[model samples]
Target: MILPPHETQAERDASAARFGAELARLTAAAGLPLPPARRLTWCTAEFEGPPATPAPHHGAEPGPPAPDRARLRGESDRYPPHLTLYRGRLPLAEGRPPDLLPALRAVSAWLAGADLAAIRRTAPFLHVQEWAFTHERTPLDRIELNWRVRMQGLAHGPYPVAREDVKALWEAAFAQPRLRRLRPVTSHYTLWFSSTPDYPFERVGASVEPLHRGGYLVRAGGGEPATVATAAEAVALAVAALPPEPV
Candidate 1:
């Protein structure tokens, strides 16, 4: 598993120091104004992708190791910790907060100057997130409506099923009963990859490509992509992934 950028308070402090310096460097390079205290904050989301790593030249600059793409993307109990482009609730720097997001987006654009899909990904992934239980929870009805694409549902007790059918499988497992407590549910369209020897990327639909991390020029989307872990889980999701209305 990839070690997080700021796994501890001390590490966080160290990271902040380095980023402040790096941001200054970036500002100078771009001829942008620096704020008194530059900070960046991460917004809540279904799941966080990998944190940005400093460029290669920043290797010896004394910072946390970048996450391991392989392990972070693999099935492992140990996951990488996450921090935004900056640290803390407020990303503070001596200089003005640089336009980090725009910078990131700009870099992405520059990297993918022509082919929009060149660095883009559209593979499906199972994102499990916690939700509020406004109502009491119940079990599946055994016979109920199959979920359409992007329907709400949960991961199975045994394991996850095919990525494409995650929605259907989830809806089937927890067919519309009220819930009391919060629990983890599947979030879709979260996982994608370039062609890898271990986990290959195939077309799940129209416009899909065979290349893993297929975007040739630049790669976007950051975060851990956890595939369905076990054999039983795959089978369960596979069964759940069956078509809603049979021909």
Candidate 2:
């Protein structure tokens, strides 16, 4: 990360431009479709509840996705590629260094193209095999729940999942660690978007309407609405909406 001593905003933009251009060039060289970058972050909800999930056996095919179970289940020797989009930022309080997030997103459209599998793959990180995620989700906890929320993003390719298609992966993430219901006014919302595409965006479990000019009119669950200009602003607004934890 560039520190204050080394650069100004203009300098940073120059650096990011150089970085993005090279990254795109190299990505093209690799023969992989250059997709847009989706942003991410960590929070108490994702980090505090569970243990790491184990990897899937090599060559094993996943079973049909179930939606009721509240657990994410899977095994993969490889890290969940989702984390890479966020610079491998895991949802742990004590793992990974504080992110150089601005830099990671500094060069938006670092790659070319418009497909969204990259964003869909990381949706709410449901069922992450923690170990695999940041790079994992267990896959079974909220398959249905996640699908319901991420349906719009993942509804492409051969097996397009419809809202009616939801079936529980598991009923819950953990029985003992029951999630306390929020007092009617409380909720958590997250907004992730790709700056490269100008307007392509995703709301994780929140309802938002896109403005043709730019920005979004976001109304999370039962909360009041707000107009925000960027994914970062949206995340901050959502985090700010959280009711203070009881002291």
Candidate 3:
């Protein structure tokens, strides 16, 4: 997770602790049993770009390094530092009860055996918010899929759910909502995190101009700090090592 340079290690630790505790508390309050928190790998496409312009409070500290302009388009100030693609939350069979490690491992191995050419054909995209001044637009034809593997509790807290039940739930939630709006967007993964504790907003909002140029920003995060993968390469490595699919 990206952090402000100005914060001390103690502050960072404290913040993380608070975040975790609140997460746990909220889950329990929702009447959802907490899933066994374990280390798992996830995959996502990230936008390679420059660090954001810091807020006024950030003036005391030097900002992140500048991005490479040669490889990027438009003004350097046009976009945020990152955008995520697919995110998978790996399930482990141990401490949490229904260990999904075996099934996770199986999926990883299967991915390894499968050809990435098909996957890569759908090169990752950074969805950026558009700005009236920029007059930018995202290409509609790109193939994008955000895949994730996570516990049902983490995905939809307080409400007990299983992998098999996700499709129906999603249809009821997302599909139904979209139908009402007359807009349709297909999602290839499950929604694990609640809309609360809105984080990464700084990073997300910074690229509003670019996002409008693109269609949407795809991002994912999991319960364990050790499990989050920030880069696509790392996610691929984990997927390749995953075991076979569970029966």
Best TM-score among the predictions, by candidate number:
2
lDDT of each: 0.26, 0.29, 0.25
**What TM-score does candidate 3 reach?**
0.19
What tens digits encode model 3's per-residue C-alpha lDDT throughout 66-155? 321111111112222221211111111111112122222222322233222322222222221222012112212111111111222223
> What are the C-alpha RMSDs, in order, of all predicted structures?
19.9, 18.6, 23.4
lDDT value, residue 25 of candidate 3: 57
**Deviation from native of the Cα of residue 71 in model 1, angstroms:** 20
Cα-based TM-score, every candidate: 0.22, 0.24, 0.19
Deviation of model 1 at 23, angstroms? 2.3
Query: What is the TM-score ranking, best to worst?
Result: 2, 1, 3
**Scored by Cα lDDT, where does model 2 land?**
0.29
Backbone Cα, N, C clashes tallied per candidate: 28, 45, 22
Specify the poorest-scoring 10-residue window by lDDT in model 1: 88-97
Q: Which stretches of candidate 3 lie over 4 Å from their true place?
A: 1-6, 36-247
Return whichever of 1 and 2 wins on lDDT.
2
| Best of the candidates, lDDT | 2
TM-score of 2: 0.24
Runs of candidate 2 exceeding 4 Å displacement: 1-139, 143-207, 220-224
Distance from true location, Cα of 221 in model 3, Å: 39
lDDT of 2 at 181: 24
